[model samples]
Target chain A: MSITWPLFIQVTLRLLEGFETTCLIFALTLVLALPLGLVISFGSMSKFKPLAYITKVFVWIIRGVPLMLQIFVVFYVPRLIWDLPAFSRFNAVILAFVINYACYFSEIYRGGIESISKGQYEAGQVLGMTKTQIFFKVILMQVVKRIIPPMSNEIITLVKDTALARVIMVAEILKVAEEYAGYALIWPLFYTAVYYLAFVGILTLLFGFFERKLSYYKV
Target chain B: MAFLEVKNIKKKFGSNEVLKDISFSLEKGEVLAIIGSSGSGKTTLLRCLNFLEKADDGVISVDGNLLFDGSDRSTTSDKNIRRKRLHFGLVFQSFNLFPQYTALKNIMLAPEMLLKERAKKEKLSAHQKREEHEKIVAHAKELLDSVGLSAKEKSYPCELSGGQCQRVAIARALALSPDVLCFDEPTSALDPELTGEVLRVIRNLKSSDRTMIVVTHEMEFARNVADKVIFMSDGVIEEAGTPEEVFDNPKSERTREFLNRPGF
Candidate 1:
């Protein structure tokens, strides 16, 4: 097929609009999930047996199911149970993505936190620091250093996982590419691969920088 | 009155009974070395003294002020526990220096937090807070120098040798000037050559009349430096006396066997 300059430009612009939706899903999920994951991790690690068990089971359920199935459940379950109006397609995608990613992030957080030696907490305690102070001032950065590699891997996976929104018919980049495939123009579908590669490449660089910055400490 | 006193400190973990009964007293300017085999509860006693572990029963008084009383519910509050912990500083066997911070910053951190808290409580002006911060930095530098690591202020824990890290840990513990500084096998993690540097800094602290409790496996160090020596066995003190009296003339069978072990 002969490709004209205008045709390529037109396809690029439409894909960019769809890419905005993809980016929004990625950014919003991260913004909401990062802190929420920390809270969930604390709940799982709580001294209260009931709270800890419930949080653990919740995280287990979220992780055991597939992401595509989760998106569908979020979109359909509320309306089915309550006879309420279905959520907006975008909100359902966001809700499902947040819960899924937060559970994964919480496990990474728990691993990083539990890896620290008990001696660190005892050192802080003997120095007269409160439990909160010990966490923020002493343990937090060490945990960050330990979790960065795992966190970055999960984050890069999220960038691609945004395409899962297409299952909910959210007109994300992949959905736009698929729409072109219906027109029997296969090149734009290949062009979509370029965008994902660039996005992941940039993220790889960013995470590498953070890893180096935190490399001064060997936790 | 003793400078520090403990009455029947008892601790248990799941009925294991790690410390059945521990009681001791230290006068000001005295060094008390607690010598014991592993599992003898020496470390637990130190942890309890620092409030890292709560003793099930005990009375701990520092400078003649009651710090912890198991019978007193009012003394066990979170706020009271933190305040009481300030009376003691502990150096761990592993030299748990904050790895992300430099030696100087590790020493400065707790004191800075303390100063910040005081500044808020006192409603100090911005200028006053800045001045207090400078004082903390200066004090931290002085502590680093005292531990003979003046040249290593900016090095992280990973960059330092085990001995160097322990010295920094010592400086960090001394930054707050606790009434009683405790060491829980402080040199046990170092190489034979490296142990000397840390021991030297501790010996200097002794000459300065800093009250201390040292839990150690070093028999010679305990005999030469400690004014009082305790031999612990099976969660209790098997023998307690002057170093000469304990080492030269041990009364307990366990103390005699422990001192005559192959390594000693």
Candidate 2:
């Protein structure tokens, strides 16, 4: 019960193990969601009314409801309705996180794309570049440049939101801290904050680096 | 047949007709200047020539090849439209250079892409394609030299002045080797002091055999460079003739009124 440095190190290392799971959820969600969001954004901005409307409504429903509820549904609904086997707990958490974050990222992508002036497209067209060429070569880099700040914000939030996986018994850092708290080890609970702050701080620096790299595009 | 021609072109946006019975023809090596107040459809007419705005009714022929027969979409196949677009290049008033690319790359991109497309069409071997690509890069460098921006080839659009950016845009347009080059008030976006640099570039291009259609407010430059001058009023060609006839002795009352207006 003595608050020894060695004891603190031992607890921190154990919490770091759980934090690895949190980091995995965050990284995988981002890797899967970023491009998925772009595809979804295209659907939302489709010229076809039925397609665009359907995508908008789907995004609206996902965003309107709570993430925790979405996780619960993702975890339990398939087996309940179809008498099918449930997904593994980690996979269920990832599925919920990917769908939820992809919708948010889609809105950011949509805004970034729409904010570009029509002149850029016209310029590309006049240069005899095809629509695909224009989108990839001219528009995509600019969109990336414009969306990075907002995307970083969402990604940082995702890092914190990974704690939500504990609701499904995923044993992420917060869950590990909760176990310690149950044993009257209150200090370990606050220790999780340092991990989160350090992770978020590194992400902030990384995003700032990206913003600087894209500075050549002043518009 | 003229090198480029538009027959009875008409365009309307909603209930407002922007171009009414517009028609013009340009011979190879001709420099035609279109002059009008804002809303006179000068820019719209230029855009129509590039197929940026499809006319409600018209026929456009570049080098006597029909690029558009507005009533028939099937004849204007996507491939044909794209091929025909290569015959004309447009420089925007706003410059419209890709902000992310350096000046050299801006000039080089379309040419390189088009060369690759052409290589596919011609079924060239890899060695032949590399040789052809080298030629394009050489031509792109020549274009930059012509625009007098050889020193700033590596500068992005934001790093360049408005005049410098416009010049880079001109170089980009020329890199495609179009039969005709069109300008839409190329200097209007520049400060008064910066206008001369761009106008000088355009003026140097006047003697070249590349057919040019310039929509400009600089009456003096137009008089000096244009083989033909058109006065547009209310979406129609009020008068058109040699520069001397249009500027010094305008036949139409509207043309005279516009020419005589203060600050024109």
The complex in candidate 2 yields a DockQ of: 0.76
Indicate the worst ten consecutive residues by lDDT in candidate 2 chain B.
B74-83
lDDT of 2 by residue, B101-213 (tens): 99999999887777878889999999999998888878888999999999998899999999999999999999888889999999999999999999999989876578999
Q: True-contact fraction for model 2?
A: 0.61
Per-model TM-score, in order, reads: 0.98, 0.97
lDDT of 1 by residue, B1-264 (tens): 799999999999998999978889999889999998999999999989998888998899999899888899777665678889899989999998999999999999999889889988999999999999999999999999999889999999999999999999999999999999999999999999998888889988985558999999888889889999999998988999999999999999999999899877
Q: What is the C-alpha local distance difference test score of each model?
A: 0.93, 0.91
Model 2 docking tier (incorrect/acceptable/medium/high): medium
Task: List the candidate 2 regions with Cα displacement exceeding 4 Å.
Answer: B77-79, B120-125
Q: Which prediction has the highest TM-score against the true structure?
A: 1
TM-score, candidate 2, first chain: 0.98
Q: Please compute and give the TM-score of the first chain of candidate 1 against the native first chain.
A: 0.98
Q: Could you tell me which 10 consecutive residues in candidate 1 chain B have the lowest summed lDDT?
A: B73-82
